[model samples]
Target: MGARRMAKGIGEFLMELVGEAVAEVILGLLACALLLSLGLIAYLSWSFSPRLTVAGAGGLSLFLAYGAWGAFRNPSKDRRRRGVAAVATGGFTLAAATAVFLFFYGSDCGCL
Candidate 1:
């Protein structure tokens, strides 16, 4: 019975994570659409820039970090796993974004 409960909890956690990812994607799409409609995104359609991308990633990491803090505050064993995963993911994303920022910044060439 305990094993079954654990499995169900794990499944729920997975689903919740998936839902969060999907929501983020949808939110990004909406933001992009809004920008395009407002003619902001079109101004640089012919160019490629990672500044916006790094900002997005950094923002996502911050969100995940906040979620991790919430998960850690939960008084449940199952949530500990989720908290660890969130911390790892958030740290990884932040590190990657920082690396990209440093590289581009040192290059002294804003966008390719």
Candidate 2:
């Protein structure tokens, strides 16, 4: 075997995606909620508010990408399916929660 697995062809990747249930978005969202709730409790020890909790939780979630990166880099074929799930869930958490930081104080995304 090569030092790294061969890159997947677009057609094969598409077929794999088509066969998967992509709606595990709900699982990702639940993880975001868990992070937020945990942050809220931790923040309460110092000072707390809904806004800070959301932003802080979102900020903390970027750490999840380490797991995704590791999963992608691992050499085992047996764990590849679980790795796909990890990437999807981690990608959603990183994109939706870390970048979003939403719905506190009737605020917008404030991306600008």
Instruction: State the lDDT at 5 in candidate 1.
Output: 100
Model 2, 21-108: lDDT tens digits are 4534444555466566655678794475767767776665654555555545656856544665577556655655544544331132
How well does candidate 1 score on lDDT at residue 111?
25
- Highest lDDT scorer: 1
Give a tens-digit lDDT track for model 1, residues 1-112.
9999999999999999999999766655554454345345534532456677567657867776765555446567554446656666566666556556445443343222
Evaluated at residue 49, the lDDT of candidate 1 is 64
Task: Flag regions of model 1 displaced more than 4 Å.
Answer: 40-112
> RMSD to native for every prediction?
16.6, 16.2
Error at 63, model 2, angstroms: 4.7
The window of 10 residues in a row where model 1 has the poorest summed lDDT is 103-112
The best candidate in terms of TM-score: 1
Count of residue pairs whose backbone atoms collide, per candidate: 0, 0
